[model samples]
Target: MTRSQALTLKSLAIEAYQPGQFEKDLTRAEAARRIQMLRDEIALADSF
Candidate 1:
């Protein structure tokens, strides 16, 4: 993944409280997917 993607993924992971869940060598698509998933999870958590 690109540096920006990696940083965004890291930030999302940290926000979702799953900082260790991401892989270091993910593809750009996978990173984007994971970031979206994390954002969804955070939103779900906030709704409770």
Candidate 2:
């Protein structure tokens, strides 16, 4: 797998350490930033 994809998965994995936990308190901007980063990583991976 590409580095970008791997990193994306890693970030998600970290965020999901305890399901439905962080989801409750994360602000809109923070969540958007994290998800946007994941999407960018996916796009980078797709190029590989």
| Local distance difference test values of all predictions, in order | 0.88, 0.53
Q: Which stretches of candidate 1 lie over 4 Å from their true place?
A: none
lDDT of 2 by residue, 1-48 (tens): 344544544566465452332343455566666666656656676798
Candidate 1 C-alpha lDDT tens digits along 1-48: 889989888998988889985789999898889988998999999999
Q: List runs of model 2 lying over 4 Å from the truth.
A: 1-23
Count residue pairs with overlapping backbones in model 1. Answer: 0
Q: How many backbone clashes does candidate 2 have?
A: 0
Best by TM-score: 1
Model 1 TM-score (2 dp): 0.82
**Clashes (N, CA, C under 3 Å) per candidate:** 0, 0
Pairs clashing within candidate 1: none
Error of 2 at 44 (Å): 0.3
